[model samples]
Target: MLKFTQNKTPKLNFKKALKKPIPVKCVQIDEPFEVETMEGVMKGKAGDWLMIGVNDEKYVCDASIFKKTYELMK
Candidate 1:
């Protein structure tokens, strides 16, 4: 029989957000960035999940969701 286990380790794609993400003054990212994780659906700005604020809020999210959700800022 084959067995499947949850990946406890963070993957490469999970490095989208840094522990200490820098805040940009006038960076406009897309909206409605959402990702389904083991916990639940995570929501944030399209290209700035690690964003500490909406023009300024201190929130936390896993890198996995951040990578999957963040869009490219133009």
Candidate 2:
């Protein structure tokens, strides 16, 4: 038998990009819906976010994740 657990911090040399900001389109949904993405068709719940990326890729993101991961482009 073998047992292992993840209790180590990442040691990979990852750095944030210092590139130009490219804005995308984002909208909030008022009802459950589905959208086509590069990955495939995905379902979203009310209050989720629909994001259209730089290359016109469309996808849905949960409201909580959208809030934590993105900001309004003002």
Candidate 3:
């Protein structure tokens, strides 16, 4: 019996989606805390961002990434 191997073809072009920036309520955690998210409970550390989504869902975001991704609304 002979076994054949399948070769995968790569796509030449990639599609990109435009993301709109929407504001959400977020607060910086002063101490370690746990937030109950839709997925499950998530742990947040001090200086991290605890975001409350439009649906009132809570989630944690790293401080570094948050700073880079979000800016204060003036």
> Each prediction's Cα RMSD?
12.3, 4.6, 7.2
Shift of residue 40 alpha carbon in model 1, Å: 19
Question: Candidate 1 residues 1-74, lDDT tens each?
Answer: 85545865533465465555443333334565655544566676555444445445444444456567554455
Which residue runs of candidate 3 sit more than 4 Å off their true CA positions? 1-12
RMSD of 2: 4.6
Q: Alpha-carbon error at 50 in model 3, in Å?
A: 0.8
Candidates ranked by TM-score = 3, 2, 1
Q: Single out the weakest 10-residue window by summed lDDT for candidate 2.
A: 2-11
Model 1 root-mean-square deviation:
12.3
Task: Return the TM-score for candidate 2, rounded to 2 decimals.
Answer: 0.73
User: Model 2 over residues 1-74: C-alpha lDDT tens digits?
Assistant: 75545996566688888746678899999999999899999999999999999999999989999888788977
Superposed Cα deviation of residue 46, candidate 1 (Å): 21
TM-score of each: 0.28, 0.73, 0.76
Question: Candidate 1, which ten residues in sequence have the lowest lDDT sum?
Answer: 20-29
Tell me the spans in candidate 1 whose CA falls farther than 4 Å from its real position. 1-50
Candidate with maximal lDDT: 2
